[model samples]
Target: MSHHRSPPSPPPPEPPESPSSVYCTPSPQSKATTPSPTARFFLSRHQSFIKPSPLTKHILPRQQSSNTLPPEFPYEHDTAKTSVGLYLRKHRRTNPAIWCSAIICLIFSILFIFIVVAILIIFLVVKPKTPVLDTSHATLNVIYFDSPGYFNGDFTFIANFSNPNKKLNVRFEHAVMQLYFEDGLIATQSIQPFSQRRKETGVVVIRFVSSLVSMSSNHARELQKQVMSNKVFYSVRGTFKVRASLGAIHFSYWLHGQCELQMSSPPSGSLMARTCKTKR
Candidate 1:
């Protein structure tokens, strides 16, 4: 009798199992498929991701900030596009004193060289001329002795100077006399005079008896020995001051001359021939 009881309503068909109920069982595959919190955050920021294999979950549509740079960005290319390059370019174009100073120095050196050359040329082209004056007559006699007996036998010289240039003025400061024997210089004498005039005949007597003997003995022993054995030729030089008045103009004169020395012996009573020729 119970078997016919509505087939027992088929136990309510156990209400067909829901899809959630079937998937509710703890499975390693389902747990592995779930994304981690870190991975989800990374996908949100990048917007895109890719997975090459089943072990990896890749987000798609990666995103980037317009102002932010990536880890692999090129720094050298970025710097060239910024303001730093423009500043360096502008600084090199201005500033010129360095070049200007070099040019100015070169010009000054050339000018200095030209000035020196011009001075040398002027000196080479100009020369001074000597003036001529009137002449007079004069005589000079120089004697040489061996025994220092003539005029006290000491080495002595007599000068008879006459100025023929009557129209000029002359001033003499230092008068030097050089005596020469056959070998070399035998004696020298210096004299100072107050003054003299043009057309004036003056006598400058120089006595070199002891001084000449001593000097010749020290420097030229051969000359002294020759003088002792034979007569020696000597020369005399004189310098004087003269002033000449031609109209209202006054001029100065310098006189130089040479004379022969004739030797004579008193004790032996023999006169030697002239050994020295006058040099003008």
Candidate 2:
């Protein structure tokens, strides 16, 4: 055996190294382990898969915004690769549009209820009543005829307006006065807007002077006949926009006043009698 001693051949060449094994055990300036061009390409492509085991737990993805975090967020870091700010996303799932709409609806409902209650209280506390119109005095100063159908006259009157409601005040707007003879319009006059306290009376002096007013045949004949008998008949109409108010409650309506007057003929002519009525 000593005379036949011979060294054994080296072991057969190892199988080609794989990229995965070569990249994991990287060493600088080592000829035997140096990767070939093909192996280098494979190593470069697979380099991202091989990572150091700094910690075992998986790291969450980084959030784009900090405000996307929870209202009560506690920072935690379980791995060296993960940051304290990165946390699992919790979708709060809220509807801001629906919440805003609900708030607006609630406010409107409260306002409507309050307004209804206030209006009801006003109606109960202040019951509105109609005002009255009456005449205190009237006189016919002159009457002259330019023709059978054309006439001139001067009339004067004091109009009395009274508020009957003890709790409601009254105001008259756009007041106008018209004089008629035998259902025919003779003259018109204007009166200023006026106000009256509760249960108070207001007076306005009105004067009408007919200047060359033409009358119908029936009206002229009736006027002539009345003048002959020393008893003249005339009518007056009043139109007003009346507002009745108590505190903050206010109601408005149109009022019509009609009066019939009997007067003695010419020059010291005075009102003998009058009948008046007011309607709403």
Candidate 3:
């Protein structure tokens, strides 16, 4: 009713083209394409799977070998620290005592050696001696007498010797008494002492006698005549030598003396009294 004319009579239906003609047909140009939202999401997910992230690229893989060292290296560091501390503590404890003992021993050794050397030098270099001529006074006395049968006069001699040393130690080796007649030597005799001591006097005694006889023959008569005509006098001379030692000192001394003799005749004898004088 609405004047709707039937839609223009339906156009004639198009026929299908031949296969050779379809190959020659030109395609239409497409509009600028925009990916759908769902398609775009799918494409982004795929790209993420193909490419790696920045953080993952920068990181390096862990080494598989056990030879690699750890970052801290705790074992070597602890050993070095422990050794240093022990050395310091030990040095602090013993150093002072060791040095002090060494110094004390050195000083004592030096002192001992010095004392020994000094004593040796003193004994080797010094020499010692004692006093000589210790005897101060001496005296001699001689007496002469004539006997009936003896041709020469009998004489007795005595000697007194004194030591002045306060602590005297004297030794007498030998002593001799020589008697002279006028200017000629007559006789000699040895004197012996009884005792010796310090600050004391020593006494010596000697006796001498002569034996001679005159015969009636010519030679013996001539000898008697010559002897009777000669003048006779008496004198005494003697030497005394002594050696003494005390401690480490040694002493030696020599003494000489001379004296005259007095001769007296007995009541029944013909010889007269006379005094003999010493020559020197």
Candidate 4:
């Protein structure tokens, strides 16, 4: 009833194409011209592995150069530091005691020079003077000769000690007198110690008596001749140790004196003529 007559017979199946058809066969020209994706990928990966990185190329030369060179000293960097190092090395070789002793000796030398200069200046400014001494008078009291070689005589003498300095005082430490008959020493005497002010003179008195002295034959004859001639010759020598003081400054000296006497007296207590000389 539906009348649908069987659907129109299904369409007939299409026929298989032949191997030589354009749609069924691959083109050899296209296959030979273009590379495969797998091959292209492999080549790109090989190139990436072989090439060096930019960072590595820059750093490698610096490392190699640093490793090859010798190590450098640190002190060569600054001139000031090098000089300081050298200075320290020099001082390290010297002993500290040596430096200290050198400084002390230099100081003492300066001080000694200063003291000497000061003393010289003081001497120039002071204008100091030396003292003087002299014999003032001499007298022959008596003269007598008994027997062949026995002689007796008496004499008196006076000495004058004077201080010439205007600002100094003098002290006589010792005074000695010797009576000489030609080259023979007959008698010696000492005087008392005394002090004299500046520009002052002190007097010393002495008396001597000769004992019965034995004389040589020649001396006795000479003396007799002198007595007959009414003249006698004698010598007096003296030594004095004196110290001069002015404030804190003090000086000492030895004084010597020689005096000659010629007396025209016989058994009298008076002098005829005398002469004196002194040295300091």
TM-score list, all predictions: 0.34, 0.59, 0.35, 0.56
Least accurate stretch of 10 residues (summed lDDT) in model 4? 67-76
Q: By lDDT, rank the candidates, best first.
A: 2, 4, 3, 1
Tens-place lDDT digits, model 4, residues 118-182: 55754687554555555656777666777777777778878777777777788889988887776
Tens-digit per-residue lDDT, 65-160, candidate 2 = 333544345343234225433554435766999999999999999999988987687667666667888996999988888977898999998899
CA lDDT scores, all candidates in order: 0.49, 0.84, 0.51, 0.74
How many steric overlaps are in each model, in order?
A: 19, 0, 0, 0
lDDT of 3 by residue, 1-280 (tens): 5675666687898888796755444344322366668888999999988866777655644543334446578787677778879887884456888889999999999998986775455345432122222122222222222333223445555555555445445666777777665434446787663334456666666665444522224433432443454422346677767665444544556666666543332212222233322211
Better of 2 and 3 by TM-score: 2
| Candidate 3 global CA lDDT score | 0.51
Model 2 residue 130 distance off true place after TM-score fit, in angstroms: 0.9
Candidate 3 worst ten-residue window by lDDT? 128-137
TM-score: model 1 vs. ground truth: 0.34
